[model samples]
Target: MKTLTALFTAAALALGANAAFAKDVQPDEVVKLVNAKTIKSLDELKAAAVAKHPGSTVTDSELEDEYGRYIYKVELRDTQNVEWDVALDAKTGEVLKDERDN
Candidate 1:
């Protein structure tokens, strides 16, 4: 029983270490999606993320395709100097997550 519990704990840690690394949509695909109006522009997505934490400045961002979902991930630093992680749906400009980074 202890061995099984250990395996579960280790697996969870491994998964958490690399939470989003499966499929990344290519740059060409990103342009196509934007032109086709299937997804919002990266600029738009970034703005949406920043709006989540007012007075926050974006530090880094990336577009990824997670199991067919176009996710826009943004890292930011707020006016108070707190780091944050934000995720948005590229298509609808929805804020999926807004968490403060440790």
Candidate 2:
């Protein structure tokens, strides 16, 4: 009985540690994802963009401040290897800006 209790305690502690490491995204920020059809995480957002524009692959992804709003910057290259940038609301997954790379 004591061994079982100890094992459970250790497992709970490990789970708590993992939770602490997880990103704590706010509810209002995550609510913006409701508009997107198939996007939940930053990676998913990039994949959706590539899927929309075939032959394109993500080249760079970063968090940037634009016009007083925090956004995720995603750069992709098409089959021709032409590059473009897509900016998304970091919290809500909404597209804020889309422009071809010059």
Which candidate number maximizes TM-score? 1
What's the TM for model 1?
A: 0.81
Candidate 2 C-alpha error for residue 26, in Å? 16
Pairs clashing in candidate 1? none
Tens-place lDDT per residue, model 1, 24-77, is 778898999999999999999998998888899999988888767888989999
Cα-lDDT of candidate 2: 0.69
Which RMSD does model 1 reach against the true structure?
A: 2.9
Q: How accurate locally is residue 64 in candidate 2, as Cα lDDT from 0 to 100?
A: 46
TM-score on alpha carbons, each prediction: 0.81, 0.51
Question: RMSD, model 2, all Cα superposed?
Answer: 12.4
